[model samples]
Structure formats: C-alpha cells, structure tokens
Target: MIDPIVMIVTMLIVGQIAVSVPILFAKANKSALNLPLAIFLVAIGALALNPIIASMAPNWYALYTALAFPALFMLCPSLWFYVEGLTADTKWQLQKKQAWHFILVAPALIISVMILMLPKETHTAIFIDDTEVSGWFVSLILVSMLIMMLLWLSQCVYTLIKIVRRLSHYRKRLKDLFSNNENKELKWINWLLFIAVCTWIISLITVFSSSLLDQFLFNGTTEALFSLILIWSLIHFGMQQQPALVTDEISPKVKNELIETLDNNKNEQSKASKTALPTKKYQRSALSKEQSKRIADKINTVMQSEHLYLDASLSLHKLAQHLDISPNYISQTLNQTLTTNFFDFVNQWRIEAAKPKILANEATILDIALDVGFNARSSFYKAFKQVTGQTPSDFRKAHQT
Candidate 1:
C-alpha cells in the first residue's frame, strides 16, 4: 500500500491531471487556451515524472510522462502561432494534420522511456529509487528534455518580448494597442494567455526538479508551493471564457488585399472609412477644423513653452487646460488624425526624442528612460519597445556603431 505522504502526493498529481487534461483538448491555438493547455500538460507530466508519484502510481505516471514530453516541445510554437493569429486579429485554426503532429512523436518517445518495463508492462507495480541517478541513460533524458525545453522557452520568450515591445506605448488603451477586437474580443483573451504561459513555466520548473521538490518536502515547503501553483493553474485554466469564433467562409483574397493596402502599408494608399473625414480640414458644426487647428497650434505652442512632454505624467486634462480646449477635443484630434490617443501621441514623441540621445550615450538607459517621461524601468522598457519595435538596448546597439 502507498504510504500516507505518497497517497497525498498521488491525489495531488491526479487533481492536476483532472484539471489540465480537458483544457489541453479544448484550448488549442487560442492564447487563452494555449498557455493553459501547456500548463496542464506540464503539471500532469511534472507530477507523473516526480519520483514520489512515480513510485506510488507507476502506470499513470508513465502514461502522463509520455504525453507531456512532446507537448512541451509543441507549446512554444503553438503560442507563437496564437500570437500571429492575434496580430492578424483572427481566430486561430489548425488543420487536422497539424493537430496530430505531437502524437506522431508520442509513441516512440514513450516506448523508449518505458523500454525496461516491457516484461512488467501488465503488472501493476511501483518502484522507488532513493539514490539520485547520475548514469548516462538518466543524463541523456535530462539533457534532451532540457534542450527541448530551452528551445521552446526561447522561442516564446523572444516572441513575447517582441509583442511587449510592439505594445508598450498606450497607457489607457493597452488592450486595443496590443490586440485587435474588430471581430471578437481577442484582446482580452491575449492577457489571459500571458498568465497561462507564466503558469506553464512554473509547472515545468516544478516537474523537472524532483530533487528540489524532495528538498522542499523535507523542509515542509512543498505544501505551500503546491497550493499556490495549483490555485494559479486553476485560474489560468479558467481563462477560456469564450473563444472568438466565426463560422462563415470569409473572403480571404479580398480581405488580404485590403489589409495589405491599408493595414500593412506604411503609405496611406486606401480610401478613408465611411465615418472618417476625407480631408483633415472638414468643417465641424460646433467648432470648425480651422478653429480646432488653431486650438491645437496654440496648445503646441504652450507645450513648447512649458515643455510638458518632459513631465512624463502630463495628462489629457492638463494639456487641454493649457490649450484652452476640452480634453475631448484633444483626444478626438489625436485619435482621428494620428490614429492614436493623446497619451500615446505625446509618449511616442518623447520616446522618439530619447532614441537619439540613447544612441549618443550621454546617459544610461534608466536616466534616458526617466528623461523621456517614463517613471519606471518597466514602463520605460515597455514604452521603448512599443515605439521602436525593439528594446532600448537593442535600439542602442543597432545605432551605436
């Protein structure tokens, strides 16, 4: 019979499996679903690979280990694909063949891991190894898994950093800045995807560090960590509120051409939308475009006098007051013409101005970041990433020599 601690651990493993398995099948390619699925697979696999759990429930353990390995490799690619779909403002879809790619590797990797158990495959047995394995075979498994994990991890990390860089400027409308919500609320789901990816990373760390888990168990820290991780996983798994679904055969070619002409084009070559003014100088019933431009020009003059952008904390209200225009007018002017909010408009200017100074090397990242109106390092990193599509370090390096 399994000891009490072993039984408790086994139940914990089962609970993780129970929560994650269904999510794995349900949330495929969806950012909200993708990371949760990865988390679930890692949690289940980590438990199965845990020495104590393996000793207590060998069959279940082996089955889970086999399943989780390739999933580990697949998670990052799937995440990148999901981000691509998000970038495109569409629901991700994988054809049948693409869905089964992980399964192709499953049988072989699993079979190899369980090669010694061929004779005892049918027997319900548990084996515990107290001594740490330092042999060639164990090392091979560890090294291979590490390499795969690192590769997958790197791909996701790079993509997320890129995503963060691309989305850092907008403070008020961060959701829409990083994602599109024209068809469905994909933006909201992308936030949950970030959480799920972090949870998946936690699960991976827990699973691959059996000795550390044993140490924690000995020091009575396992329960606390497990509880936190379990709760985190549960929260991440719950991210599948509703998928951005569309059933119609959307006109791909026409939409693609339009997107290429408008969305991707640096040049403004498409007709303005029905609601948008054909010319920037359209007459308004209450305040004409000429009047608005006068107001904007006066505000620009005041901004130059006060150097408001240097404040970094300057807001719509303050700018509007100084310009003798309502905040609504300022917001509308920036949004309609610049295709961005007032906050983003100002921040973009600051970040752009800072880039040259960053290249000049008169100040460090922190000083330049703060000088550009960003209060914190994180905000600085995010703002720079958004404006430049690269980190400050990257941007600096590119222009330094």
Candidate 2:
C-alpha cells in the first residue's frame, strides 16, 4: 500500500494545480510566465502520481519507471524558462534555437523505454525485484540511472545558481534605472529559488540512502508539500507583479534616448571596473562645474515647465529619458550640483504644486493630494510637513482670509 502521508501530499499537489492552472490562464498579464509554470506543474504532478501508479498496477511499474525519468528531466528546464520569462523586457516566447534545451528529455524517455522493452524477466527483475537480477545488464542499468540522476541534479543546481545571478543583476539594473524601485524588485523569487534548492537537496539525499527511503516516504511527501507551497506562493504573489521593462514603461522618444544612453554606456564599459571606490564626497571627474551647472539648470527648467514631477511614477531613468541625459550623469548632476537626491527633488515640486490647491480650498485634501501626484494621503502629509513646516490643514487655515 502507498504511504498515506505521501498519498495525502500528492492529492494536495493535484488540488493546487487544478486551482492554479485555471487562474493563471484566466489572468491577462504576465502570460509569458504561464507556459513555464504549466510545464513545471505538469512535471511535478507526474512525479507525484507515481505512488498511485505503483499501487494500481504493480505489474506496470516498469512503464512508470520508464516515463518518470523524462518527467524529472523537465523540471530544471522549466524553471530556467520561467526565470527567463519573468526577467524579459518584452513578452517571452519560445524560439527555434531554444528547442535544444529539451534534448536530454527525449534521450531519458528512450532509455526508459529501452529498459522496459528488455526481456520480460529482465524488466521485472530491474523494475520490480532488483535482487533477482545479478547480471551485467542490471549493473549497467543501475550505473546509467545513477549517472542520469547525478547529471539531472547537477543541471538543476546550475540553473538555480544562474537564476540567483540573474536576479542579482536585475536588482542592480533596477537600481541604476529607477530612483524608486520598491515595487519592481523581485526578491520573492529569490526565496522561491532557495526553497527549490532545499527541495532538490532533500530529494537527492532520499534517493541515495536506502535506509531513509524504508523508514518513511519523506522524499515524495516533502517534495509534494514544497511543490504545493511553491505553486500557491507563485500564483498569489506572481499575479500581482508588474513587468519593469524600460521599453514598455517609456514612450518611443524616451526609448530612443535610452538606446543612445545604452550605446554610450557600451563605450564606457571597457574602462570601468566593478570595484567600489572609496566613499568620501561627490567628485566631478569628467563633469566640469559649468557642465554640472548647465545640467542642473536644465533639470529645474524641465521640472518646472514640463511638470515632470506631476508623474507619480517618474524616476531618475524616466527623467533622463525626458532630457536625453544618461541616468548616471543625471544622478551626478543632482548630487554634485543641485545637492539633492531624486526623492527630495521631485517631492519639492509636488509640495510647491500643492500650495495653490491648498490656498484655493476648492477640493478636498485627499483629492488635492492625489491630483498633485502624491499616491497616498500619508505621503502627501509627510512631504508637505517636511517642506512647508506645517500640516495641510494648518497651512490652509493660516492663509485663509
């Protein structure tokens, strides 16, 4: 009989997939991540189904063993694909070249089939009763399975590490591109990948040790439980995540400016190093005092005339796009010349804009707050107090005739 705990966990896995798959498809956004997620669910579900398969048809255990390896092989590939989709600037689609990623799955399937296609006694001995076969064929099969498992484990680890590195790079990229990236940071995925690594490690331990396998089916049960959590967390959190692609977020003219900035960055890439320089104070190396003053003046002019601060979503990168300036240069100009950061600089304008609204007393405080590009009432109050030395109500009452 299949272990009840394993059975329960497997059922939970099935239930999670049943609910999540439909929701994922129904959602209009982040559909790029759906295919990889679907593939991952299918792979996990197939593995979880093994206990049921073993119970119902003991005689057909050979066939289950044959297919399970290939299913297992799909897990890492699916994960890598999901990360690729999640991090892409535009909607991700499978290209003809990416077909090679699944090349191992076919071979794994064929090997399983070939083993099952062996003589009846050989197949039975290999799949059902290993003690009955002490031949070279059985030894060869054992070695091959061991080798395959090791390779699969290696690939899973490699892909997971790549995901970590990619996520790190993405975080740095976001920092460079946006003044406020609280919403765009993908830290949840890091936790997900960590859990996956733990799951994979537990699976490997359970597979190699016969004593552990005999005591309790923790391997399958743990995997099923973790898979359930992973899927649920993904569905709940993943749906809320918005893409942070520069091309999608900015206009065509802004995109052209960004492209030029990128081209200039490429030119500077060779001379730059990742090493951190000693932190003292802002220094103007290539940017002269006159150039810095010009940039700072231009920034004030643009912010006042164009009312760029009215965009609640504006960032250093977005502002750079507007002025056809590189974000690095913009940051330098703001710090060295203007002696202000992006947050204070933008909020200063927002505070100035709020003054007229407060004086007029035409709209409610909340409405005025939102209209002046403050997303939250609390944020507006905080910035207003910081800038004006008085609350909105106090400021309005004091100015009233």
Candidate 3:
C-alpha cells in the first residue's frame, strides 16, 4: 500500500512546480521578486521530493539526493532575497556580495558527490537497508549531515532576524515617502513569517526527537502541510504586491538626488552615533530655521490654497515638485519643524477636511472618506479615530445630538 504521506508530498511537489511556471514566465508588470520567488518555490519542491524519491525510486534517489540536499542551503537565502526585493527602494538585482550566502552549499555538494562515489554495498547499507554501518566514510557523511543541519538552523534564525529588521525599516521609509500606504505595508509577510517560524519549530522537534516520535511527525507530512500553507500565501500576496517605491514616477535626476541625500543622512547618523554626540536629525542640513519656517509657511499656503490633500495619490515627491523644492528638504522640514512624517502630516489635513463632511452627514461615510483623499473607508475610519479619539459614526452622533 502506498503511504498517504508520500502521496501528499508528491501532490505538493507537483503543485509547487505548477504555480512556479506562471511566475517564472510572467512578463506583465515584471518585478525583481519574480525570479527569486520562483526559485524559492522550486527549491522547496525539490526538498519535498527527497523522501518520496528515496522510498519509491531508489535507483534515481542518489541523483535526486545529490541535487536536493545542496538545495537546502539555498532555501533561507532565497527567502531573504525575496524580502530584500520587496523592501528595496530601488531596483533590486542580485549583488556579488550575496554569493557568500550559498557557501554552505559547497560542503553539501561535496558530501553528495562522496555518496555517489561510495561503494555500492556501502551506499545500499547506509541509504537503502537502513542497517548499522560504521566506517570512516560513514562517519564522515554523518558528521557532514549534522553540520549542515546546524548551519541550516542558524541560517533560518539569522534570516528571520534580518527580515524583521528590514520590514521595520521599510515601514518607516514608507511613512517618510508616501501619503497613503494602504496596501504597501506588506503585513501578510509578517503572518507568513510566523507560519514559517512555526514550521521550523516543528522541524527542530522532529530532528531531535527519537525514532518513534519521528515516525509520527517527522515523516515530512507536518512540514509539507506547513510548506503548502506558506507557499500558497506567498503566491497569493506576492503576485499583487507592487514595488514599494515607484521609482519611474520620479525623474532619474530627482531620484538620484533623493537617494544620495538619504544615503548621506544615513552616513551622518551612523557617524554621530559612533561619536556619542547629541545631534538633531538633519543637524547638518543647510535648511536653517529661517529657511525651515519659510518652507513650512509655503507648504501651508500651497496646501490650504490648492487643497492638495484631497488628492489620494499625493506623495512627498509630488509635494516637493509642486513647491519646486528637494524632497529631502521637504522631509527634513516636516520632521524637524512640523514634528510629523509625510504620511501623518498629509493624513491630518485629510482628517480635518473630513470632519465637516462627517458633521454635515449629507453623504454616506464611504462617500465622505473617498471625498477627503482616502481611497478606502477603513483607512478613513482609522485615521478619523486616531485624530478625533472617536469613531466617525460616534463623533457624528455626539455632535448631532
């Protein structure tokens, strides 16, 4: 009788390959994430095929093992690259520095080659018969597997920490760069990470447990189920996620200037922290208090006169363009003078505009939300409550009564 677990894993491998084809071939609205994501799925599917091949087709198992074991080293790095692609401010391409992430693969490849070159009886004793085999080669293979497993575990922990930090920085950057960040937050990735952590925990348990417990949970079924969930969620969310920064919208000169200014600011902050000196953000900024005040006034004049807050698509770059100022300066003025980010500053104006409309109660809440530069009612409600300390309906009821 065919084991149900083998059947499930087989289906999963097929599903992963099936989904990856469309992603790999997708040409419309191409993203840097596409190739990494496809590779990630295929790598995972290859890993999933390991046991099925071992048991069902023992002849091909050595070749499959040679390929799949090495692929374990690529899993976490592929995931890291995908997150990096998502959070990158510019076009993300693989950098030469990242090649080191796959260094562990070399040892796994060496061990796999040894397995292929091993004597037929020895290979059969180790992999097929599951009989006790003790020799220098056997010891070497066992030690290598143990070392690779530990390295893979360490890679998982490190990748998770890096991804968490990267997501934090990405969110902060979004606040600085955008007015309304509805779908760009990538919260789904957080849930995906949570699922991934849970899956890793299960794998750890399986790895360290006795043979009895391993039979029940470590037989690939539990991990396969979790993998299925994680991959499906990634596919669903990744396909819809647009690049965080729409670099094409800003001209190359402006984009280069903004990137340079931001990089310089980061370098300055790093130096300041190292020096243990108390320095205000943008302390090196040439925008003096006088200039800041002038800029602030100009900003208010333009906002009040032009009502730019009513445009849901307004962004820091767009505002900077309107005032014929650099985006870095606008960001600095907003942070240093106004004590708010571009997102909160614009949203506050939007909420203020929404207040009178809510009081008038002439239109539906959703209609009012759309009128005041909110693309969605949920966002409008959240902002309204944040500014007013009451929900829109509750505020309306209190004021009207």
Candidate 4:
C-alpha cells in the first residue's frame, strides 16, 4: 500500500508543477517576477519529489539526487528575488551583481555529481540501507552533505532577514508615495515568511534530535503539508501583486531626478547628524523653510478648494503634477513641515470632509465614506476614528442627542 505521506508529497509536486507551467509559458504574465517564481515553484516541487523517487525507484534516484541539492539551494534566493521584483521602485532585472546569490549551488552541484559517480551498490548501501561506509570518497560525500545543510540553514536565516527588511522599506516608501495602499501592502508576504521560519525551525530541531524524534518531526507528511501551504499562498497572492512603484504615469528622467534629489538630501542629513547639527528632517532640502510653508499652504488651499483628496485615487505624483512641483518635494514638505506622511495627510482631509455629512445624518455611513474619497468603508471607519476619535455612528449619536 502506498503511504499517505507519499500521496501527499506527490500531490504537492503535481500541484506546484501545474501552477508553474502556466506561469512560465504565459506570455501575458511575463515580468521580472514570473521567471524566478516559476523556477522557485519547480525547485520546490523537485525537492519534494526526491524522497518519493528514492524509495519507489532507487535506480533513477541517483541522477535525481544529483539535482536535489541545487534545488534546495535555489529555494530561499528565488523567494528573495521574487520579493525584490515585487517591491522594486523601477523595473527589476537580474543583474550580474546578483549572481553571487547562486554561488552555493555550484558547490552543491559538484558534490551531487560526485555522489552520482559513485557505484550503484555504494548508493544502495549508503542511502537505501543507511549503512556506515568508511572510505575517503564516502567520507567526503558525508562531510559535504553536512556542510551544505549548515550553509543552507544559514542562507535561509540571512535571506529571510533581508526579505523582512525589504518589506519594511517598501511599505514606508508606499506611505510616502501612495494615499490608498489597500491592495499593494503585500501583508501576506509577512505571514508567508513567518510560516517559512516556523518550518525551518522544525526542520532544524529534527536535524539535531534522535532518529525517533526526527522521524516524527521531519516526516514527509509534515514537510509536504507546509510546502503545499506555502506554494498555494505564494501563487494566489503573487499573481495579483502589481509593481509597488507605478512608473507608467511618470517619465523615467523625471523619476530619476526626483530619486537623486531625495538620495542627496538623505546623504546630507546623515552627514549633518555626525557633526551634531540641527537634526531636523530634510534639513538639506533645496526647499527653504518659507518655501516649505508656502508649499504646505498651497497643498491645503488646493485640498480645500479643489477637493483633490476627494479623488479616491489621489497620489503624491498626481498631487505634484497638480501643484507643479516634484513629488519628492511634496513628500518632503509633508514630512518636514506638516509632520505627516502623504497617506495620513490626505486621509485626514477625507475624514474632515466626511464629518459634516456624518453629522447631517442624511446618508448611510458607507455612502458618505464612498462619496468623500475613501475607497472602502473599512478604511473610512479606520481613518474617521483615527482622526476624530469617534466612529461615524458614535459621532452621529453624540451630536444628534
């Protein structure tokens, strides 16, 4: 009888392959994300399939095992690249500098090849029967496997840390750039990383434990289930993810100039902190304090008169175009002078606009929320409570009584 664990692992491999093929071949889905994502899915599938093949068909397992280490090494880096592709401010392309990420794969591949070159009887004795084999070649293979496992674990730790930091910076940049960050937040990625860390911890514990504990904790069923969940979540959320920085509306030259100015200002600020200068944010900005005040006033006047905040799709770039200023400068003005981010600055106006309507009590709260620039009622409720210290319904009750 086929083991249930074997069935589960088989299903995971099949499911990943099913998802990966369409993504790899679909022309419409071509982007920086697709290639790494496809590779990641396939690599995971390969890794999951390795043990099943070893038990069911030992003869073919030699070649299959040769490829398995490289697959294992590819997993974390591929996931990291996918995150990089998702949150990149510009179109992400694989660069030569990123080649180092795959360096471990070479040594892993070489060791796998050495193992493959060993005699078939040796493979059966060492892998299938789990017999102790003492020779220079066998010792080399065992030592290499141990080193690879350690390196892979370290790589997982390092890459996960990098991914978390990247997500933090990406979210911060989103606040500076977009007013409505509803779908673009990529919060699921955080959950995915958490699950991955948990799975890694379990596997680490299994590795250090006795054989009986290892059998219980590191069984095929548990690993396959975790892989299934991770792959499904990754595919579902990743397919819908759009580039965080939408560059289609803004020209490349203008975007580059704005980015350069922001970088220069940051560098100046960092240098100033070393010398114990007035540690004000944006202290090196070309916009003077008077100009910042003027810009802030301009923003308020425009919001009040034009009701630009009423546009649910309002963004720093769009606001900059309306004000005839750089987006970075507008962001700088909001942060330094107004002491708020673009998101909060705009949403506060939306909440204020929503108040009189709420007090009038003539329309449904959802209706008022939609009419006043919030895309969804939940966001409206959140912002309203945040800004006014009362829910819309509570505010109405308080005022009406």
The global C-alpha lDDT for each of the candidates, from Candidate 1 onward, is 0.51, 0.71, 0.80, 0.79
lDDT of 3 by residue, 14-128 (tens): 6867866476658424665676777777787887776677768878876786788888888888889989988887888877888998888889899889888777777778776
Tens digit per residue, CA lDDT, model 1, 313-384? 465545655665554455444544445655566777678778888888888888887786767677677777
Worst 10 residues of 1 by lDDT: 170-179
RMSD of 2: 7.4
- lDDT by residue (125-230, candidate 4, tens digit) is 8877788888999999999999998898899889988998888877877777777888888999988987777777776666556365545556655656776777
Shift in Å, residue 252, candidate 2: 3.2
- Among all candidates shown, the one with the greatest lDDT: 3
Candidate 1 yields a Cα-based lDDT of 0.51
Off by over 4 Å in 2: 22-31, 119-125, 128-132, 208-220, 259-293, 300-312, 316-401
Model 2 residue pairs with clashes: none
Worst ten in a row by lDDT for model 4: 265-274
Per-residue alpha-carbon lDDT of model 2 for 1-401, expressed as tens digits? 77788788778777777777667666525465777777777777777777777787777777777877798989888878877777665567767798877777876876787787677777766665555577776677778787887788788778888888777766645543443455577778877877777776676677656555455445566776776677667666776776574466567666554444333322122112212431122332466668878999999999889898888788777787688876667765655555555667788898899999999989989898788787778778888999999999999999988
Q: Which of 1 and 3 is the better model by TM-score?
A: 3
- What are the models' TM-scores? 0.42, 0.69, 0.88, 0.88
TM-score, structure 3 vs. true = 0.88
Model 4: which residue pairs collide?
A: none
